[model samples]
Target chain A: MLVAGEHVLFHRARGFGRDTHGASPPTVLRHSLVKRKFFRLKLQRERTFAPVRTLYNLNLRQSGKMSEKIVLYYFDGRGKMESIRWLLAAAGVQFEEVLLTKREQYVKLLNDQALMFEQVPLVEMDGLQLVQSKAIMNYIAEKYKLSGKDLKERAMIDMYTEGLNDLMEMRMILPFKKPDEKQAHIGVIQGKATSRYFPVYEKALNNSQYLVGNQFSRADVHLMEATLMLEELFPTILSTFPNLKAFQGKMRSLPTISKFLQPGSQRKPQPDDVYVKTVMEVLNIQIP
Target chain B: MLVAGEHVLFHRARGFGRDTHGASPPTVLRHSLVKRKFFRLKLQRERTFAPVRTLYNLNLRQSGKMSEKIVLYYFDGRGKMESIRWLLAAAGVQFEEVLLTKREQYVKLLNDQALMFEQVPLVEMDGLQLVQSKAIMNYIAEKYKLSGKDLKERAMIDMYTEGLNDLMEMRMILPFKKPDEKQAHIGVIQGKATSRYFPVYEKALNNSQYLVGNQFSRADVHLMEATLMLEELFPTILSTFPNLKAFQGKMRSLPTISKFLQPGSQRKPQPDDVYVKTVMEVLNIQIP
Candidate 1:
């Protein structure tokens, strides 16, 4: 399901001893690009950096192998894919991206029937072409068992996640806003977060450590990702909500999430001018 | 969470004996609204609108009773609440809508912290205040076992539902379009449905009786809803897609769905000028 020759595995291993999680020692998943064929991976013990060895290029879903990498299809920015990236990272799942750089690159995907709605942030996982940010996250969360234990808990998680998504969406479109209007847009995000959205989360955190259910779930992961995004915009965004502040620290300290925060991880930076311009040109559309 | 004084159960009985499913005879659920308190309902055999008697003023969630009606909070329109109405109707689950007419009504809900993101289409069910249309729909679908039985099936259902939602959203905004520009908007919908969306569903239907799993699921319900929506715009919208054409007919024949499609049911009409004006004033914002 990958656009040929455009695959690059966003490996978590910063080539050797990085942030190690509990219990299992980290194994490096090194993937080599094979055009529209199969995903080849070599599992190297930490700091091995062995010769380019080829192991089974097995289908992750077909083999029911949790260790194999997932493929993400999207443009080279953080519009919709950022949350997908967040969930995957939180699950400690390694993934590769087919970053569409040209209009033709995106259109080929359309012609291939790879995108259900002709939109990106499509993840090829468990033998399915996953689209829609919420759907993608829901699948990943359920796969990782971050979605709750029962139907009611999952429902609560979905509700809280949806609310956090509303807040994240306000910040997500900032890069697309006109430069002259950017400050006003930031003001809106700050105001909404402080007066409305943050207060809700703050109150929820007061009752439980996680947003939904007693354990960490998709809602908590989303809140953490959103918290980091908001912090990047205004460093003091969570200053008034002490619960959120403490929640932010606790979230950053999670083993998988902490690894994602490192310097060379797959997390894309805020949309720079070039990234935004490229997105505008490649999509050839304007968001109203 | 039944808001005081505004609860009216939308029962599907055209006074009983209307449409029967399988071997099970239809029973009538009659509701009487109580101010600020509880939902009181009486169960009667078909054709009996018995004298008002008080049953348990049940909290539907805590009592684990599925027969009790769910309460929906939204403006009296088919904006985001329409899909909800569709799912509930398809499940044969009766619901009451607290339709907001004034700006202060919505503002009061905000002040009361009923709306997590300051938006409506909130459903008060199972002792929880649920916001966000997708979350609410997912909860309902899962609770009614309309969502797929397994993770992969659920994922596929989610993916298909998301695609259909994209198409529905395009039509959803038409009510807000300028009166002079309405035709152009309709044209856009027709073009997108025939070109981008309908074909996908048509192809998916070509594969199975249902969109995701072997049985009826949320995706199937959404497709049925969207098909009805598109047909309203252009009668021949599905003429080119035989699978979808057949799918629509098959879906409407199901007992619950057949009842929902009946006239005098809770299915909302396309938003009128008054609905649009109230939405604009009550929300007090402009989209882009």
Candidate 2:
């Protein structure tokens, strides 16, 4: 049984069945059950009359349970979850993409009492609903052995990936900038940040073929995603750093990675590019 | 020898001596050397004529070199590095605090070539000049065996700590809020976040004495720091959560932690805080 009262309610409400053993639930399940329960209570209290539903139904029919079935929840466009998607592909793991492309669906999920931090790039696996992109990615990375060879390597990967994620967050703010301010902000990024930060990546790549361990790592995946985003905005961005360019090329050519980069699967063009859509839809504001 | 050009310059500039083996420097040493070197180059490039100095001088006189000595560079205030300081205290490790209280000294370190991300809470240990508080904390946690008993425990600790850290980040923005907006923001936090987040902690504490593995952890330390900060601002904040209050009391009762809480070693009041003084002094701006 879970310690939190609301979690107990959530598990019962979600119809979360017994754990894999059917005798004793895992500790993670207790954590998840409580979190979802707590969130559900908050939702019910805040919007008493509104019909709010959990994002995903508790599917207890899978043979392997949480271990076998991986569900990723994110907006329709490939934004924060793209690298995660790439990681799944690279790891050769099959997953269910529960892309909440519609405004209504997003609102519903936002109101869902199960969302920790009330944000996405949430992942459901192994009987737990893990929130926070970094935490989710780390879980996947650890499970798939993509973290690194040793603890030190893992820490290095975490460090590099953290830096890359920070850069991604900076980019996420671009679409929200006013038209007048957008150009100037972009100028600083393209002119100054690209030169300052990219060379750092280029230098890292020069030392090892990959970012962290000379082996493919979550850091490389994160860096590759950043490179794709930046290059999409400014095509000639990577031209100055040959090592990074080559590194980008190498990452893009990975058979698993290449599949995701195909025109059909590639990220949609901006404007409604996830974050912008999130703000516009969430705020009910018309982005000009 | 380190691979990066600037790092080589940095190590030489910092007067870093070769490790005991004297063949190739350790990985952490190389990492520190490169970070310092890279930051130094950036400082030099940006402020060509400015007098840029390193954050801390090379102290290789210690018998064990980097392995033995630990240096934490931050403003005297218990800001981002507070949790780290607590961790070191809890670990009972001796560390040197190079508090950048002087404006010229702080500015010099800020403009130092080795300060990556150009931010503080920089740590020097194990021959690595680690930037980013989170990274440094994780490193220390791992090194000190305070992370968790195993990977699963570590992940759980990470998940809980991540939630706590997110909350901490939210509180960090409180100081900048205008008076008019402050109350509304505090209302949301006290009413919504406290009700939602605190119960989880309460439940966790109810289940076990510690946040993770029923043993002392970095997560508990971080939570303690957050609790202290929150209680400092809103004295009656934890009155509703008896379990958390008890947990805080238990944590405070720890001898090492108690020592840190003692008034003499306590952080001084802000505005004329260390980092602010550094900036005002460095820029020669008159503080009202």
Candidate 3:
């Protein structure tokens, strides 16, 4: 696939490979043949005038394959953007993370008329600035075939993903909450809500190794991120649900996921609590 | 198509048509021929084990076609189920609504191990009991080709739908807010958040008649629902955006949408406040 004058190849089991041939690129093969054998090579070559144009061209490269440039813009926190980061890693999609922390940059991004929502975890991919985390996640899932085995499976995955989102929403606290209130809030989330939700997950995991199906899907990935989050915020929360604990262990042990989570690996940890930092360190996500 | 002993024909423009020819059913033609010209008739002949089996066997139905049986389970309220109801109505898919109001039924459903999440808004169709409003909506969208023209268009639709969902989440009231603080809370949401977010939508509407594309897609349907909710909650909110107002009028004016919104139509308004009641009445949605 020729993208931005660069020859890129996407291997199924392996990550992206680049075969830069400068101006005189190698003769591209029919994308159909490549797709049948290797991966779904998406090539974006159009220079459209629209602010967002996510067009991809699929040809071939003689050597290895490379993906289009993906830059993830987010704050220096593992809040809403962590799942997206994890999704990129799980999909083996090569991306550069731009951790924006400065107040000036926030003001600039907010004032920027081009940005639809002026929000982050904004994914700049294939010349389109994609907003909304779930949208980005769904896009990656489709592109990588991480959605599900079938339509019903995909819908079930969506259900589980939305459930995880709801669980996260239940844990939120007001910014004006006093230190004591914060403790009480966490207690409420961990004791009541988490206790109620985790068992359902435990029951599901007991039935199948994964959340949706036999294979690891985007739902499992999302569940993993949310689970880690809960664990970080309230340690020993998952200890009661043995199946959920097992599920977490199984998910983290995946080669791609483990590699991303590994302390020495490339995934740099954003601003989080002590527990999250510890989890990151154990998982090999660098604590910045 | 042969569903049970009855031959059902599903017409595109018109709803289902039933030609129940007792034991000696009419000569069944191959489904492919019916699909090419007359209608996209889905036939399920399998006498499967499931309690609900959505099956259709097509023969010569003289008048308009008929579809398989669909059961929609939700509360009497329109909270999350209204969009699903709208989609079903728009698709012209014949469905039976099982609105559960009793706490005993709720407990029974919760205990029913068949339910994945033990949640309402469960759609029993095609031998599968589907849950989650968005998931069900997507399923119906795909079934009716309301998703989009293609994959990219579908992704765009997903983006806009998620965008609308984000807006809804932003409008939610924090549980901990005091009675006095609630007014201030609404003020911040309406003032700072709505001001910052709504212009992007206005701009998008100005660019196109619908949210995703020229044609009315699922995204437009979702956006319409959310826009109405906002309008109901905060009267005169859309006065600033003429394009959006026009878009709402245009969407509400659509045949299927207008039919769904009509007061005398089959749709009965779910439990909501006086504000929502007024908006529904103006939109021709019955305030039941």
Candidate 4:
């Protein structure tokens, strides 16, 4: 199970091989070479013995029933689940995806069984539920060996990932309200961006091509997500920071991210997209 | 040196045997005990580690300082530095408290040092600067063994501490403004208190005595400072929440706290006692 904010996702076994009607149960099956490598990566990153053992025990409980694999419970567009989804997809890991569409359905599921958050984007591995977007993203990244190899580089990844998260929370999440109020809020955010945040990122980018290390890591993924949102969501504010714009361009040009840019892969804009639209309108910029 | 937001503090060494200034060069510190413990607690709760050793090593630099102890830099009033101060006091640790009185001074310091935030409540220990209040608090708590003895209890401490910090940021920090906007903002904060935050605390308090364990951990200190502020700063909103009132009373009645309440401890009301005055005026209640 995984919980972030008010969202919770859980995985339980139906039987051995079949997908259960109520809750999906764990399965024991042979993994692909990539999956095997992912599992080794997870083991290597986990330092504590207790929780690792607990996860192992959970897998053992369903060992004889079916094949072993990972499962995810998530909401489509809330919190930090999107990055986790991207990480899993990038790593080529196949897992069950359960999307909770309605709030009522979400609450009912919570009442029937234990849910981490009252909301989605939770990953249930073995029996344990993980919450918090950073935690989930880092976990999946570790499991996939997507984080940088060395210790210092890894710290940089954590730092940049966290920095991106903080930036999004301040820039996008909190200010994402009605149109007029959002505009006012964005003005404040823009001021800070010009004065504080953008300069920091500009300095960071000047120091290295990537936020953290030589190769792309979860930090890059998070930055890509934030910058991509700005491309659609807050274009006007985004225009002030040309370096940030270039950074976004660089990230989207990456092979893996470039694949995601195919026409069909783009998600339809939500009602909240108006905020982004307004930002662009204010900035007089067009979305790509 | 540690930086959280706009605050910075430094821990510097005096001569051996005699405590005096200008004896040695100061080192900068990043992330406090509270922040580290919070991160660790999040990692533990998630049962995931992405380069755990990297985080551990980043944290380890705080331990090797030779001469200095902890020094806090922040604004006056129990804003960000309260928890760190309380943690040090609880652990019987020594620290220097430096208050940044003006915004210009803060910006000057930041420009001079390239500090992360031109803010307050930063701690410096053994020449390193640590930022983020939760990080600082947890670091001190861990070093002194004040957080918790067991893992589960420690996690609970983190949960409550994080919640309280969220509350403080929402209540105390965001709404505060120049005197001209104070009245209107007070009403907004009052509405939020009555409509949102109060109920959450009431529900949480119904189940747990302390935020986490039986012992008075840093969570309690954080809760105490926040609740105390609400009582003083936004009394009108607090009036509806009797359980919260009783909780504040319970905390204030503790022997250690009672001593601080006596005449000379600086608990007396001052012009800057926005938290205290607001709560008192709104709730029409007095602390014994």
Candidate 5:
């Protein structure tokens, strides 16, 4: 038998208990036979019900519940969640932003018993839970149709997203290390970004205004966040790439993003701030 | 416009291409229209004409085309390609092994004008070029119906594949640096695997003989390759994970795989042995 919000499958010779129905067969064998018949019928019903059960349940729950349909559990700082939140906003979807304190509260969340990746931003949508920031962003882009409109666009978006992810992973080592080591690492990355990555981005953006195409996409949103981080965190480092700077400016000018950058809007900590503090101490830059 | 053995899709004139065929498009787009159209048609045609194209184009063009319909461009010893080759063989798929020369040839390939990522184990499936070993392995697994039967099972397979990839990226750093540094890095990874990864794997196995369901899938192939690499490349590192070792041994015992490992059937290097030799020496490992 198929329930309203669930598919109930009964195995062969197994049926709903007879006690609840107030019906009993004349004898044990007769009862068993009746149960077997019901079991077969219920199995048939389940086979028909299996495909649409979950979809139906989700629809029902979404329609009935006034609670937030999507909740993104993350820290307020940009680090990982910036691109995802941007993507969700771009999609025009309504979602709850559950912010956590960066240092202690965030670590506690990672240690939570039910958390999958020991990280954030974790996105819960319609009951499905997704970890991995990139995966979550992609899922939201997918659900809301904010990803590119064609196959090539999606692949290109994927390529750029993966590339940015690689860059982010490399950049992450900067903040959690010693001063000298951090400077050396940043120098290597800055050199590479100028000579290697910037060229790729420049060429990618040359014929088209955006990274993938003329219209903006999740890839653009991701690039926007990454470029914003780079500009605020390592301004002088990537100054050699004029095209990249211009691209960053163009992204920031978008009305959707410009509002977010208004004066007094919260700004995330950039590695550059940390670098500056350490370097000033090393080189004796006075505090005025 | 749909073709057999092909997941063909045509974007309608709806500005955003709507797939008229039954192909499932990914949720995001990030490519220009020109590139998007090219890949869509190419992927569609490749599926339909792969066998024919391989016989005439790739196989006839290369000397060893007669050996295997699937040619995996790899190195002499173990690296990223091992898992891919293992997956193909485990799936009972016949493939030609094209080993490149290590120092001169491998470096040349990396510096190839057309190459992306400067790496190998590029799988030539029926003449279509597939880079990224994980993507290639996935293509093969999906085509052969060896990934998983259901959505949940497929997601689990993806989880394991992604986890192994994360570990592999860390392990790759070992060959590019000093021995002490390499050992320290290996120690960190080993600790994490013991404390984090191994437990996850153990729970997934949970007394089951296979990773996904009753039958062997690409997850098993990946597990086999990862375990073998850990044991052979970083001996004593995986000794603590007895269950993982047992699982590898169990995978090796499969008839399809066991046949490949039988005496004299092992493949060799073409001209890339020198680079492999240098890398091995740098890592302080003797070639068997």
Candidate 6:
């Protein structure tokens, strides 16, 4: 990839960790800080703002801190954007989020024709504005060589990640469940995790320490992410799944994943009531 | 791709339509039927049945007709597997289905560990047991060249298809909606189809005749399928979206897709009462 008429080097998205691909760290990214009092909408690229939303004037003191890096646009909480954050962190890619705190910010994106489906976690990378979380994850996974190397290996990785996605999606909707129905929904999640989902991952891990291509891939990243997610809901979530526990431990010890696990990293804590309020307020939705 | 120790000559997965790739037919697939008055699942593969259920004795007279090609395992309805069927048909690939009508058939597959995640839509093709509907669709799409040619093009295709899928999934769960809630759900689907989704495709189609890579792709196929689905619910679904209507016309005029649309073909009609009943029984789930 070329930038500024020169071959740009990569440092795993210019992350805090070192690139495992043997690329030195000084090619694709370099930006000087520019501070002004105006609501400048140029996010490493030039764009005119419509002034239709208060978001254009919100405190953007952090923009210069993350200049020229991948820009992720979403709310201030862990909704659909969480998994993309997880995948990028696992790939050792550093990104910054333009958090939407008000409903007008989302509407501004829609009015500018920025979001394809009028929905986000919109990511700007490689000179492209990307939407759809799965597509973004696939792109980052492939770019980082975490996606499989062959067609068959890709098939296995796709299958495992997809199954884990089904499980994660169940919890992803927990905040929307009615208060009366929350318990039963949790029961359903627990039932499906143990009976339907966790067993498959456990069995898949039994044959090899890795999920796809017998090496670390996005599937392993997802498995480790999901186990920790379930553990949040139920502390002993992996009690019956010994292999998954061991797999989670092994995944956490990887260089990239281990760095991500450390404090002061980009990983967000689990969403709380305040986080939920900000998300629902920005998206303008009521709990179902 | 090799099959049976020989370079397999492909005819677009061996269908009624001609292969546009210019490969002569007949080097991989050939099977003679063995007539036995039992539920033998030797669909071009050697596997002994334990005979633990009535599915082992159910009528399977049509298995011989679809031998040596793809074997799709699902119920006789247009559920999640419908898009896979649409993709295969659009690719002009011939496939067979082992329809499940009884709970015991599902139990048998579960006992045999055929389903990786204890779910249906399991497919047998290219000597691999493929699970996860999206994974199966991706595999088939890439094999038949409905997927795009490069990474950027593939990203575009994946993005459009993912958006279309969000719309399609809203209708897919309608079968499980409560009797009294069905009307409201239908209203939601129609509202989202017209307001949220159609405009995106309309604008996308404004730039080119195709959705990705200036060629036919799985995204186009999915948009066509989704528009037809919405039209089934609302006859005037595409009245406001001129570009989408034209795109649909262009897609439907393709030789392979037009053939699949014809009557007396392998295409299943919209699900009626019996189809829903069979699916509910086989899966053993109450309406949520």
Q: TM-score for each prediction?
A: 0.77, 0.74, 0.65, 0.53, 0.58, 0.77
Off by over 4 Å in 6: A1-68, B1-68
> Tens-digit lDDT track for model 6 on A1-288?
111001111112211110111122111110111111121343333232321222332223224332345777776556677778888888888777776765555555555556676567787776666888888887888888887888788888988888887677667656544465468557756766776679888888886899876688999988888999999999998999999999988888888889888997767677677776776555444332
Which should have the higher TM-score, number 1 or number 2? 1
Fnat for each model? 0.36, 0.09, 0.20, 0.00, 0.00, 0.30
For each candidate, report its DockQ versus the true two-chain complex: 0.19, 0.11, 0.11, 0.04, 0.04, 0.16
Model 2 chain B scores worst on lDDT over the 10 consecutive residues at B1-10
Model 4, CA-based lDDT: 0.45
Candidate 5 ranges with C-alpha deviation above 4 Å: A1-76, A80-83, A93-112, A117-121, A126-129, A133-156, A209-218, A233-267, A272-288, B1-75, B88-107, B117-156, B169-177, B181-189, B207-218, B231-288
Ranking by TM-score: 6, 1, 2, 3, 5, 4
Report the C-alpha displacement of residue A113, candidate 6, in angstroms.
1.6
Backbone clashes in candidate 2 total: 6
Best candidate per DockQ, number? 1
Model 3 regions lying over 4 Å from their true place: A1-67, A169-177, A192-194, A233-242, A266-288, B1-68, B169-194, B233-235, B265-288
Q: What DockQ class does candidate 2 belong to? A: incorrect
Of the two candidates 3 and 4, the one with more favorable DockQ, higher being better, is 3
DockQ value of candidate 2 = 0.11
**Clash-forming residue pairs, model 6:** A9-A27
The weakest ten consecutive residues by lDDT in model 5 chain B span: B1-10
| lDDT of the structure predicted as candidate 3 | 0.52
Q: Is the docking of candidate 6 incorrect, acceptable, medium or high quality?
A: incorrect
Encode model 2's per-residue lDDT on A1-288: one tens digit a residue: 011111111121111110101112222233334555454554431222112223445334233344446777665555557667777877777677665544444444544544554455567777777765556677788888898887677667766666665556445545544555557546544643353457568878876788877689888888888887888789988878888888888887888788777776534345454555553453233322
lDDT of 1 by residue, A1-288 (tens): 011111110111111000111111111111111222231122222221122211222233446653344777666667778888888898888887767666555544544556675556777766677787778888889889998998788878887887676667666656655565567557756765775568878998995788876888888889998888899988987888899989988888899999999998888888787876666545444232
lDDT of 6 at A18: 8
Model 4, span B33-56: residue lDDT tens:
223344334442121122111112
